[model samples]
Target: MKLARDTWLIFQRQFLLLIRNPIWIFVGVFQPVMYLLLFAPLLKPALNAPTQAEAYRIFVPGLLVLLAIFGGLFQGFGLIAELRAGVIERSRVTPVSRLALLLGRSLRDVVSLIAQAIIITLLALAFGLTVFIGDLLLAYLMLALIALMTSAVSYGIALRVKSEDALAPLMNTIAQPVLLLSGILLPLTFAPSWLRHVADWNPFSWAVDGTRALFAGDLGNDRVWQGLTIVAVLTAAAVWWAAREFARSVR
Candidate 1:
């Protein structure tokens, strides 16, 4: 009960901070819109899917979900900034449970990312993409999961680096490679044979594939379950690492 309450309090504070700073939200929406309008059309010709419409349908969800993950992951810079401002150090002296603090921070990013996903979904709908209620719900859930996983990873990175400059380069390094290898912008079938194997093993590939399936009305419960399983395991690993790093910092 105490942990949950503390977590909520922390979440509320973070939410207020986010609301006060609207630039982050604007950037989150703008980047994905750029990808959708500018990048998508530019790359349309290169996609070798059976049909151009099929290719568009396949890749749009992947890109949308990738935006969610990127938004959530990079938002850790806010946490790092807070830590540098002595907020985290002050919180450490409080009665709040460490887990609660961590969860609160992560959940804030998840919420923000989920909102970004919804905005993107609406934009897609306006562009003539049709999605069923059930499929849309599933896509939202998967995006939330992706956001949670990315938040955990970001928390780990923030705790370890503790510098905004360091976090920026790290975020770029992580996002670029993951986006390239995950087939979010291009289908794996179109990649070179060697790179195709790498895409197969990328965890982000599962997320992109799952989102693509949901949008295409082909998502199965089993595939959703598998993707969630991978996400859960990754989240656990990231949280554990972040917790350990946090503990080390406070000591």
Candidate 2:
């Protein structure tokens, strides 16, 4: 209960700060919307789906995953800023649980990612994308988990580096390969055999495949469970590492 209460208080403080500067919320969603409007039309021909709706069915899931990845990864920048401003330093003498410090910030990032995701989903619907409500909710659940996992990792990295100059290039270096390997813009079905084999080891690839399966209404697909399991395990590991980082930094 103490941990939960501390987490909630921190979350509320962070959330209120977000509400004060909400432009980021819209700015984050804007790029995905542009991709949906301008870029996705080109995929219809390449995908050769029977209709645009079918094309969107494939594209939207990948776009959401894209959003979750970049959004969560870049969140470390904020923590870096806070650290320099002595926010984390001030916490060293506090009674707050170290785990709560990580969870509160990560949950705030997840909420923002989910809000952006919902906006993208609604826009995709307007473009003829169709998905069942149950599956859609489950997909959101996956997005939240992805956000939590990535943000925790981001925070851990930020606390270690504590410099935006270092963090920016480092995050880009990490994100670029992860994005390419994950099959976000195009499915790996079109990839050569060797590339497909390489992608098999990428957890995000499993997530993209699983999310696509869910969007296609394939509830029984093995990718769905596999993705969930991989992501859940990684999330646990990330949270543990980030919490440890917080504990060390604050102590």
Candidate 3:
């Protein structure tokens, strides 16, 4: 009960700050929208998709995951800013639970990412992408899990490094490999046999495959459950690790 109340309070404060500076919401969506408009058209011929709609169905899911991955990984920059400004240091004197501190901030990032994802989905609709509402919600849940996992790790890293210069290069290093392995732009199925085996080791690849399956209206696909389960475990571990970092920093 105490943790929940503390989390809500912190969430409300952070959320109000977000409401005041909402431009970031659109800024984050812009790149994806550009891809949707300019780049997605090329996918139809490249992937041999039957129609523009089919191409979007393939593209949008991976795009959302891409959004989640990059968005979440980059969030540590904000933490570094706050640390320099003494925002986190000030919070150390408060009675808040350390875990709540991490949860509240991460929830904010997750909410923002989901809103951008919704915008992408709606735009994809205009391009003729079709999906069941139920499956769409499930896909959103998966994206949320990814966001939560990435956000926690970002915060943990930010607390450790406490330098924008170090954080930036480290995140880029991690992001490049993850992005390549995830196969967000096109399915790994098209990759050479050896490459497919490499992608099999990337959990995000399972997530991409699962999301594509959901968009295709395959609810019971093993990839869906596998992706969700893998992400859930990862989320739990990340939150635990981040919460520990928060405790050490603020205590």
lDDT of 1 by residue, 133-203 (tens): 89879778777777777887787788888888888888889888888888887767667999988877788
Q: In order, how many clashes per candidate?
A: 0, 0, 0
* lDDT digits (tens) for residues 68-114 of candidate 2: 99999999999988998999999988899999999999999999999
Model 3, residue pairs in steric clash: none
In angstroms, the error of model 2 at 22 is: 0.5
Give the clashing pairs for model 1.
none
lDDT of 2: 0.94
Query: Which residue runs of candidate 1 sit more than 4 Å off their true CA positions?
Result: 42-45, 48-55, 221-223
Q: List the global CA lDDT of all models.
A: 0.77, 0.94, 0.95
Shift of residue 27 alpha carbon in model 1, Å = 1.3
Ranking by TM-score: 2, 3, 1
Order of candidate numbers by lDDT, starting with the best: 3, 2, 1
Among residues 3 or more apart in sequence or in different chains, the pairs in candidate 2 whose N, CA or C atoms overlap within 3 Å are none
